[model samples]
Target: MTEAINDWMAGFEARIADLQRKSADLQQNIAASGATATSPDGGVRVTVGPTGALQDLQLAPSTTRYPPAELAGIIMRVAAEAQREAAHRVAQAFAPVAEGTDAMRMLQEFLPPPPEHVSDAPVDGLPGVDDIDEPPQPSTPPPSPPPPAAPPRPPRRPSTQDDDDFEQPW
Candidate 1:
């Protein structure tokens, strides 16, 4: 019975370790993945990290031709594009962990797809795939047989001898 419990525990721990490794891999991929987008005329550029936070921005001297409001609009649009692209990369990064699971479906439903044109910037390319992957679930071991009941001792026998080892009533 003890052996059985040990075997079950070992297998459960191995599965847990595998799950942790998968989570780490997914996090590393997400950190490494990001996207950048630029306006068509190259007047505006925006870079976003895996989480869609703006990491960098660049404006060309030619952008001065546009009114301040117009340039702001252009910048906003390009930033949004970069954010969308970053979301796509993040989704890809989650693939190893979430693919074909309900969590992946939720991610696909929430994370926006990358822009149609990769030529917008010099950023890395993203596949047309949608959705991420699954989340981890802990497994429990089957119940083990209860420990065997302790053996019973024989009943005490009455002493028949009047030796020093025996106690006698007065």
Candidate 2:
């Protein structure tokens, strides 16, 4: 009985050491998690950390060609792309320790959904900016109503009986 108990105790200690090593590896992966992404136009670059928080941003001189609002939109799209990639890295880092566990479920819930692109492509079949160069065709005005159907007849003449002057019915 004593020999069996000793063997079981040794196994338990080894399991604990293995768990510690895995924990250390998980910590290193988490610490190293991050991602970078650039805009399609190559005008903006963004980097994000494990939690999808912004870490750095870079703008090329060509970015000035875009108006301020357009430039801002490009930066926003690039940053979101980087953040999404960082979130994916974080998920991968959790795989060794937290996959298929409640912790992974919570982490997934906390991560942002994939980014949605809104520009360049036509929406609902409407022409995008790239699809047309000419100014939009002027909208046609509605036709005028058929010349007011032959003018209304003049007002009827007043009758003397309807007059209120002189206390008479006229």
The candidate scoring highest on lDDT is: 1
Sliding window of 10 residues with minimal summed lDDT for model 1: 123-132
Itemize residue pairs with steric clashes in candidate 1: 97-134, 98-133, 98-134, 99-133, 99-134
Best TM-score among the predictions, by candidate number:
2
* lDDT of candidate 2 over 60-150, digit per residue (tens): 9966666677678778888888888888787888888877999999988978787775663222333334446644444567787776568
lDDT score, candidate 1, position 25: 90
lDDT of 1 by residue, 1-170 (tens): 99999999999999999999999998898998888998877789999888889999999997776667667877887898888888878889898888999988898899865545433221122211121132233457779999999999999999897677545664
TM-scores, all models, native as reference: 0.59, 0.67
Off by over 4 Å in 1: 1-7, 113-170
Q: Which pairs clash (backbone N, Cα, C closer than 3 Å) in model 2?
A: none
lDDT of 2 at 139: 56
| Global Cα lDDT for candidate 1 | 0.77
Local distance difference test, each candidate: 0.77, 0.76
